[model samples]
Target chain A: MNAPVPGTPEHFIANAKDRVFFAFDRSDLDESAVKTLMGQTAWLKTYPNTKVTVEGHADERGTREYNLALGERRANAVKQFLKAQGIADARVKVISYGKERPAVIGSNEYAWAQNRRAVTVVAK
Target chain B: MIKVLSRAWGRLGAALFAVALGVAGFSGAARAELRIDITRGNVDPIPIAIPAFGGGDEQSSRVGADLAGVLQADLERSGLFRGIDPRAFIQSFASMQVQPRFPDWQAINAQGLVQGRAEVQADGRLRVEFRLWDVFSTQQLKAQAYVTEPGNWRRIAHIIADAVYERLTGESGYFDTRIVYIAENGPATKRIKRLAIMDQDGANHRFLTDGADLVLTPRFSPSLQEITYMSYYNGVPRVYLYNIDSGKRERLGDFPGMTFAPRFSPDGNRVIMSMARGGSSDIYTMDLRTLERRRLTNTPAIDTSPSYSPDSQRIAFNSDRGGNQQLYVMNADGSGVRRISHGAGLYATPVWSPRGDYIAFTKIAQGRFFIGVMKPDGTGERLLSDGYLVEGPTWAPNGRVLMYFRQTPSDSRGRGGDSYLYSIDLTGYNERRVVTPVQASDPAWSPLIP
Candidate 1:
């Protein structure tokens, strides 16, 4: 692999805020999430060949099984936005980690707000 | 056939063990017998005394003492009995034979008394005999004996406790069962959870998996030494079956999509679970024998956590089809679906009790979580325990108790929080922490060891 190309996964992540947040128990994207997904959409458009994985997550409050389904809905929501914004649906794969992987380690609202997120991961 | 089964159980139970002594009928002419109504609230624990068991020899005598200690602990932990201090004894473990003097036990304010003797048989097997007495009425309530491998002594104690609990409470005993749960450690963001099993009293603890992959929501097979749980192995989420005795692990199937919330039917012949595809999930069942898969729910909304009623004729599952996540029940053939949970908050994780009377579930409402149960018809809803976070209620074999996990909130600095298992009486009292080696969650209680 070449060392540090500008259109590589690391480059894309370094240059963009690649994740969006959701309200508790709600998967619908808000205004702020839409604004961020537009940036992710733009990046995917510029790097047309780059395939990205959208990973969904949830806060620690929901049950494991339900959060999984919830995560799927959230990730699918993000993936749909990217596709609607001129990105190909086939280019974006989605998976849900549910509450298994958290963005932060705390149980408070701030940590929960961060944990309930969907991140865009580019392939190596 | 019965003889063959008992002989087989003789080899399978702990070590070489089987009930050698038949239980005598609880006898008393007096109607004023002592009983613990576990279903009622504001009830006091009955004071009971269990002096160490005695023996003809010193070795057996020591073994008896250990057995008595375990028995007492089991009863006290149920929160239906308060163990009377042995130091306040008017009688000693050695002096008491097959029966204890009621006056001696009554003097210590005991409502129940237990006396037993352990002896090593000529074949080197341990033979134990015990009798439970109603102290107030001065009548024998229960008597039984057992012979088992000397090392399988804790099981002997558990069996005795079960016998006595059934006699006094008019309900089956859960003492002889085991608990399987997810043992978690490491950071919150990257918790390493392993499938672990232990005696119901937290003994004989062992981890089945090495935490090589993330495992969650382990549930026991009601009819076998097997469990079904979800694991993210190779970054692909799938439901898997783990044989406890064989130490074998196998994925349930090559499903079309991600699968989770796996549970065995009451008969253990099938596994019911949820599979998600393209952002939608539905309930399903797989016949373990022929590897046949059946879709039980086909709604666009998320439907998961399918649990079979004791009869296996109906299934209770939680779904988001009715807007909010709520409990719904359907026939085994996937017909006549009806929503059972009409509570204000969203409902998830609906597990049917073994007795076929109630379904247990996790309810999230008003910024908190609760472990609750409701009649299968959705009536008689009762929220048992509430905390910052508590979920995953598994029924004890007897259906008189439920085990669930609770998590405490970490401070803003991400410090000071723990997750562990807890059990409560069916009436919502007697809530006690079930001690585990690590922060444990997603507990599933096994059916009573046959």
Candidate 2:
């Protein structure tokens, strides 16, 4: 809706916060999501004292425990990308909620896709 | 008058002939030994007696009576032990505590005796002491003490039964443990599930959370105190760690996909589960200490329900790699994978024996479910019981028996559905139903107390 947040690939490549990002399903980064991650990385650099906990979650179509591991993988994927973008590895921690926590509560595909996401929350 | 006399003469002649045959039969009986075979006794149950615990006032005495009732019911439901009527007692609780007169107990033929005393401590905690005795030998088999809140009198009774069971059977007792299972309350088409836990005997039952979303497959840790289960809270079925004591839970693993069928490693340090991604499931292990995860399987088949050997060096899991579901075993490091089951039916939920001998599993054949066990090498396959739908075979700590869940057949209208938990010896004897208020499934037996 709003103009995509500003920042380029080079800016994110040099910044530590930009290393962490989210991808859609198995797809790599789309252009708009990458720009949004760049903006988040810049904000993280401004608050150097704060740390982040990246929690990954999945949808309810599969088995419970497997979804948990899958969510963890998604969270770690974000952590690795953030580190590559220039964020110190020490500032980010990752956890997987599996399907324990969901943003949408329904049995449809649309709801599931929205639920299968990784979120960054303040840690300590 | 002449006809009647003739009939009497005929009867007398018959009597004389019987006397001659009786003498011959007596001689044959004297030459042969009298042998009576007792291959079976009353499969009814072994009778036991629990005298009311000594020392409690009007209010606390009521608690004691209720506690003993629960213990009696727990033992009876197993169909292994029968509790003697309290009114049949030859001596009162006070006299038995001071001196359990063996002759009095023998008079009633009480094979086992449970006598105890309860006191309200100054700290407001209930201090209960009990002893289990063998009436025949007048020997004290087990003695233990417990301290808990006054409301936990029922738990104290379970502890005593567990002690008595261990002493008499020479095996660890499961009565003191708790069961975390999926409690279903609604219709078959749209059932509501909430995680529920209670004493193994079904006392002090409580729900962990509201049935806000779908929950399934709740399992207890080895210590029998914590729980790990799958919840569809946010539209995803994931594993969640819940501590029974603290009532706090945290998600496990950090994966890019789904995790399910979680079980604690014997040491309680690692979690072995199945992870699904790209429409395929595989086994994986995550170290609780380091948060490092290693994939255990790479095949493109459905691999789920992973369980660990008691020694933690090997794993037993279920896979459809050979076309249909079957059991497989592999090293902890994911090497040396071998198919173990070649049975006729598709097998699922293979749990390694705690004694490290047999693997308990669920077999489905011809639309009927059966609980069975087999050697690790897939030999000696024995189906313990068959039902409309039977699944989730958890072993007793001794490994000599198993407990599983059975779903009853639908009613005439085909609308009523009911299920309950059951336990049976490996020999297929002593099969009995465990009583519970609501329908329960997916039972997991815990190890005996340390």
Candidate 3:
């Protein structure tokens, strides 16, 4: 298949920076995550046919299993916010990678803060 | 079972070995005792000499050397005995079976001596005979024989070391045990983790699960042949039961919500786990035989990481019901709830020790993590080890040692981040890193195998 053209609405939805971040061990979206999610919702509405997968993640801190549940809560929170902003529930899927997947690769707070995130990826 | 050293002196102790000499027909008494009188809680390791075994054929000779090496490593790692350099040994292996030249050992300042002989029988079984001697007392303290299949040479070595430790310190040995942990690979963002098991000393290492999906927090059952851990097999995190012998996997619960942080009951017949639903987690127990689920704790906060006492009478766990993360204790039925930890930091993973005297916990404060233990009522809390990231403390079967994991910081580029498992004595001394083939975390030590 031919590669999709860059800078399309779908492309913006799939961008890594389109992710909504949360504080440590929390699922509620902060002001920064809310601003990012607004931009994502605007682009997502431009392409009505676009389906997105909301993937939730956690920083490597607490117990492994609890982190997983926390990740799910983050993803669900993101999904609920997106749907309330006019994204259809049918077009959104949610999954949690837990602490298994981090956006940054360090043990410090900076890395952990960056890792606690949820990204809306355009489904292929 | 033999006590040769008097406790009143408190400076030295004896090393005794009780073996199945009846099968080997070695002629002397089945038990031999020697007195050295070393104290139990010495920081400095007692200098000891262990010569290679004699009278083994080519194959047995190789096995014998490996056995001796493993024994030496076990003793040294315990922080109780230091093996002297073989190059300084004046008595040959052949001379060790007979009366050792006490003068030669004394010249090197050796406090104790261990000598053994190995032979492969006509039936293809290997027989190992060992003797412990007190160099200062110039007396043979203990001698015994072990007969087992050739493939089990390492276990035999561990058994020997345990006997020596028990005889000397008047305490049970923890050498003949296994540890299960999460082995990690890949970069920090997308780390791959698999359940791995190995001998206490990192020998016979093997992965129990392929890293197809993420697995973590593996805990051995009271019986050594099975384990309980959390896995995301189908993209839904849940607790699973894995049989070590048959390689079978079974899901513990089909709860609509996530079930994680599972540990076997002290009786090994039920599993105590935390089930998360509706933005809250609660501790629950499920009978293995009947699949009956019992809710032990029902609070709004994240009440997880439940561990049972040795007698299964009380449960110790971590919860946020007290406003912040702290340790709490309640009856097995979730009654008589009381807070145990009032420390300055957030406490997670409160494991009731197997000996029922203390509760091990991980404390996070001021961006640093600490492994500490306290009494059941939360008094006398002493932090054992502190680091950039240290957590997941599990007690050894004997409850004299605690093992946990520590993670070092990685640079902004995500370079140099590594995690290692460590063990420390209950007194907060003799901390040793448990070496694994790769980065490891969440260590769970098994009870001594039957």
Candidate 4:
């Protein structure tokens, strides 16, 4: 591996917010999510070789099988946003962890608010 | 992925036998003296006296006591019978062999009396016989004799309990069944879930798979020792079929994208599951023998958790085609689809009862999850219980009860998250927590063992 550079994935993650949150059972990206994706859009356009993967997640309020689909919708919602912002389709992929993997461990609203999210991962 | 772990995995191979003892002219018109109307919501537990089965020697006597104890436990656990204290018994097991002194049982308020005997055969096998008598009527209601391997006493005990239960209540018993479920442990963020199976009474607990990868939603075949479940092995979700007896397992199919929430058809000839492609998912079925796949539902919305009716004629699944997740029913050939759940909330996991009368499902309303049942045409919907996150209702083989997993919410730091298996009567009366070695979820009860 080469030395750290300004256009590296680490730099892209540090400068641009790589994640967005969603409300309960909702897939539509809010204004804040758009702002986060706009930040990532600029970084992805600059780093032509960098391919990002959008990972969607859900809260534990739903069944395991349904949450998987919900997570996919959330991830695709991010992918659609990036495509609208001039990010090519080939540079971005998507996956969903559903409720199987949660960002926060608590069962409260504060934790769920963070758990229901989509993250743009800079693929190595 | 055909990993064979030796073939011909089986049970007590033709050696076990159960014959009705003294069944000549057993009165079929006799009324139940200690009757339980299971059709109703709740009933008082019947008091029954189970004296130890008489045996000739010490070892046989020990086995006899164990058999009687297990039989009593199974009946008591059903919430239908109360075992009288043996210390208050006025008659001995030997005396009960000839006939039970009706007054002695009536003195203890016992409406029923169960007496049996155990003897070690010359070939080292065991012979266990049981007789169920109505204390007030002074007549033998049921009697059966089982001869099997010496170590197969527990199963025989369950069978005897089933016979007695059927004799008392007009319905078949679920004592001889097994429950396959996901045994969850570890932290909230990274839970280790392993496939585990156990007897109905929490005996014979064992894990079927190591927790190397994430596993979920284990469902047993209606007629075999096989189970279909999903696993995220190598970071790709695939449905797998595992045999409990042989310990051999294989990937069910190689679909395009993630294949999950797999359940066998009622006859165990095929598997129905959800395969996700892009942002949405759809239901698909794969023949177990040919590996031929058939798409059941074609929609952009999520269509998953497909379960078949007992007759395999209709499928009741959960779909979001109508904007929100609710129950849907379709013909076996994927024709005539209609929404079955008109409730204002989301419904998932629609498991049809073995008796083909009602469909059990998990519903999310307001901010709570509930275990509920509904008829095939979506009528008579009833919520059995609701909680913070109660889901996955599986019907017992007899279809008179349901077992599901209930999880209590954790604290802010995820300290007190507790999950337990619970069984509730179909009439919504007896709700009892099933004992498990670890935190459990996604319980699927096996059909009554042949």
Per-prediction DockQ, in order? 0.70, 0.06, 0.42, 0.70
Tens digit per residue, CA lDDT, model 2, B237-277: 57788887667878886676667888999998888888766
Candidate 2 on A26-117: residue-level lDDT in tens?
32455654665666667677766667767777754433333454566677766666677888988887766655565654544565676677
- Taking the tens digit of each residue's C-alpha lDDT, what string does model 3 give over B264-383? 999899999988765577899999999999998877777888999899999998887877778899999999999999879788898988889999999888878899999999999999
Whole-model lDDT for model 3 versus the true structure? 0.81
lDDT pick, better of 3 and 4: 4
lDDT of 4 by residue, B1-450 (tens): 122211232453435677667743224535446667889767889999998877888988999999889999999988899999999999886733476777888898898888899998887889888888888767787887877777778788888898888989889999988889999999888989999998889988999889998889999986657989988787777889888778898888778677888999988899999887767889999998898999988998999999999999999999989888999999988899999999879999999999999999999999999999999999999999999999999998889999999999988778867889999999987899999999999899988877
User: By summed lDDT, which 10 consecutive residues of candidate 3 chain A come out lowest?
Assistant: A7-16
lDDT of 1: 0.87
Task: Write down the lDDT that model 2 would get.
Answer: 0.69
Q: Tell me the whole-model lDDT of each prediction, alpha carbons only.
A: 0.87, 0.69, 0.81, 0.87
Residue B352 error, candidate 3, Å: 1.9
Summarize candidate 1's per-residue lDDT along B1-450 as a digit string, tens digits: 011112223224544344434434445546587887777864788899888888888888899999999999999999888999888998776543334666788788999988788888888889887878888887777777677778878888998999889989999999988899999998777789999989999998999999989999999887647889999888888999998767888999889788999999888999999998877899889999999999988878999989999999999998889888999999998999999999799898999988999999999998899999999999999999999999999999888899999999887665755899999988898899999999999999988877
Q: List the residue pairs that clash in candidate 3.
A: B11-B37, B11-B38, B12-B37, B12-B38, B13-B37, B13-B38, B32-B141, B33-B141, B34-B141
Q: Which residue pairs in model 4 clash with each other? A: none
In model 2, which runs have C-alpha deviations exceeding 4 angstroms?
A1-124, B1-44, B95-97, B121-123, B409-414
- Superposed on the true chain A, the predicted chain A of model 4 yields a TM-score of 0.94
